[model samples]
Target: MGTQQTTQDKYYVVVAGDTLSGIASRFRTTVKQLQIWNNISDPNIIKVGQRLLVAKATAGEPQPGDPSFVPFPGGEWFKTLPTSPIIEMMGLRLVEEGCGAAYGFSGPGPKWNDKHRQAYACFQSALGYSGSDADGWPGRKSWDQLRVPFPEEGCDAQ
Candidate 1:
């Protein structure tokens, strides 16, 4: 929005086929608000997987971009060849939770692969999710519970 950034803000990760107006409608906010919140001068310039502030955070929400706050990138994000620090952060968190013991050849790297999925499934199972819920795809609830640490200082997450 401005040089003075708001520390606490709610975020939404953009996904395929999303338009600025569509996102605004989905979040029940105005496109103008989205622009102001994200400092987006061109409404059509948003890219897939981009994170946008949808609203101001209420009490108890974590600060935006802080290590304690990680927004849920949609499940579709994992299907793609993601290379963000967030992926590595998630892998480490899963391993910490005892889900990534067999991380295959490269170990817990920054790309999405079967290893990550398998480990995530293990985490989900530990959390008591089963059937379709424990399919290794990260849902909002499971993701929030995972608590992937924010990327190290100076390392931006996608």
Candidate 2:
């Protein structure tokens, strides 16, 4: 019987000194699993900023956050809003739709990661945007589609 590799329900980003073997060990996954998850043709090579799917996603995990999930003081959602758990929650919904990279979400704080970018692209594509429109960024249509809460009272659905 072939031994099965185990992984977590999250994603891991490659850092400056990360190795496939090291990552596999850190996530308790096998190098082969990492290769398959990230489609690495060469296990010996991985970029520092590359995202790796180290685990399987949970059933209905990390869905888009409700209006109350905002980690900030007020729910001021909008295009180019500061990063927060709200963004991470949207990323989860993207994963459920299968546009999420095999990897998972990261930087639920004031930063961005490849995982989110890929998922954002998926969201944009799903919204019928193509060419440059599909670039991995947010818009009112997507915010409504993804159910991101309003940042202010005057902001109506576009």
Candidate 3:
């Protein structure tokens, strides 16, 4: 669908798979600018079907590509995993992204090994999460950005 435009800004309807970064990238704006315009506290907590206003950048406004965003894992997680497939998938994706030189590669394994955590933290840091945000806690924001694959659907007892 086309973005709606107003007198001084544009608008986008959040879809099922929309992220602030993705949206900002599409609109040629920054996540921080979108947040400031929309009063969003968390860049990762956008609701589906939500209409977001994008203020049009003037000549002096910070043009696109202010803070380049690192790409996240481009995959979905299983809904009902037998084990910790989510972590494993993230780890695998990290290695695929060439950020796992220190961790090597061992995805779809049973354990959320040290390599997994290190890769996850690396991902967080790349996404600009420093301090406590990059604590490798598998937060929803990062997980969403990671595009966690859907689980097998009913494997809570392994």
Which candidate number has the best TM-score? 1
lDDT of 1 by residue, 95-154 (tens): 656687759656698888788888999978987999999999888777866656667663
Q: Per-residue error at 31 for model 1, in Å?
A: 40
Residue 85 in candidate 3, Cα distance off native in Å: 2.5
Question: In candidate 3, how many Å is residue 28 off?
Answer: 15
lDDT for model 2, on a 0 to 1 scale? Answer: 0.56
**What are the clash counts of all predictions, listed in order?**
0, 2, 13
Cα-based lDDT for every prediction: 0.73, 0.56, 0.57
Q: What are the per-residue Cα lDDT tens digits for candidate 3 across 1-158?
A: 23233345668899998888778646644566588889999987999999998656343424221222222322233222324544555565555444576464334354665656677778788778999898655665665455433334422213
Q: Clashes in model 2: which pairs?
A: 76-151, 77-151
TM-score of 1: 0.55
| Candidate 2 C-alpha lDDT tens digits along 90-134 | 555455444666344432333345566667787688668988777
Best of the two (2, 3) by lDDT: 3
Spell out the clash pairs found in candidate 1. none
Candidate that beats the other on TM-score, 2 or 3, i.e. the better one: 3
Candidate 2 minimal-lDDT segment of 10 residues: 63-72
TM-score of each: 0.55, 0.39, 0.41
